[model samples]
Target: MATDLVRAFVREDLKKSDVVAEVVSLVTVLEQEDFRKLLQEFVDGIDQSMLLDVHLLNGLVQLIRNAPQGYIDVDDLVKILGLLNTRLKDTHKQSTRHTYQLALTISQVLDSMVDSQVKGLSREQLHEPLSDYLEELKQDQDPYLVYQATYAY
Candidate 1:
């Protein structure tokens, strides 16, 4: 039921700013239930190659962010981040901003996973993305963006 509801939300059309809050609420509820398998199945079924609309991706990021720490698999996070990176462009400013937000949230999530001593994600899995994202932040032309990215770390 949770998966179906979340998937429906992802499929439905939503106003730009509304997706994040709704998804965060849903994630919090799912976290209380410890719904790992449901999230895993949903994430695995998604096609990362396709261009995701910003609203949908924003909701996804929020979902991951608010979900219980270490509940979301590292592999799923990696795939979602890769898809988000592909969609990160200057053309859509809102999406780009949310993507940065996602990046920051991901850094926190990774830290929580490490602190909790979760297995399955190797140190390399955690470090590689951290380094790559840090590099990306450093190269960003916007000082504000770099600041946001670094502050997240």
Candidate 2:
């Protein structure tokens, strides 16, 4: 419950940013089955406000970057992660450095989550997504992320 409250607080702060709504909207559309919207409709709407809220986005990213199965509040956690791949997918060098930085911060937080003791979560659910994101961080060119993943596993 504490973690949930903490996450909620973080989410509230993120929403205060000018871009959160746009980014969340894009992410929602990305999750949709319509293919035509993913590229045009989604990308056009995203902006720095949504992309640049470092703490809020990172908190959401870390919240779902890695998760355990059977956790009492698993669904709440997983929903947060939906952004890293979609909302943050536009990540790049000059364009999204800060966004990428936030993602990196999330990687660190995710590493901690992986290392932390978990209860009520299934190992499969936890490891799959976490490991996937670990690789994602690696691809993002943050080599240091490996150590955290090593500890987490």
**Candidate number with greatest TM-score:** 1
Candidate 1, residues 124-150, lDDT tens digits: the string is 654465556666775576676677667
Candidate 2 accuracy as lDDT: 0.40
Worst 10 residues of 2 by lDDT: 34-43
Candidate 2 residue-wise lDDT, 1-153, digit = tens = 333333343354334444433343333223322222222222232233444555454434422333233321434333333344344445553444554554565455444445544335445655466566555555434444444334333
| Candidate with maximal lDDT | 1
RMSD of 1: 5.4
- Per-model TM-score, in order, reads 0.52, 0.36
Q: TM-score for model 2?
A: 0.36
Residue 22's lDDT within candidate 2 is: 34
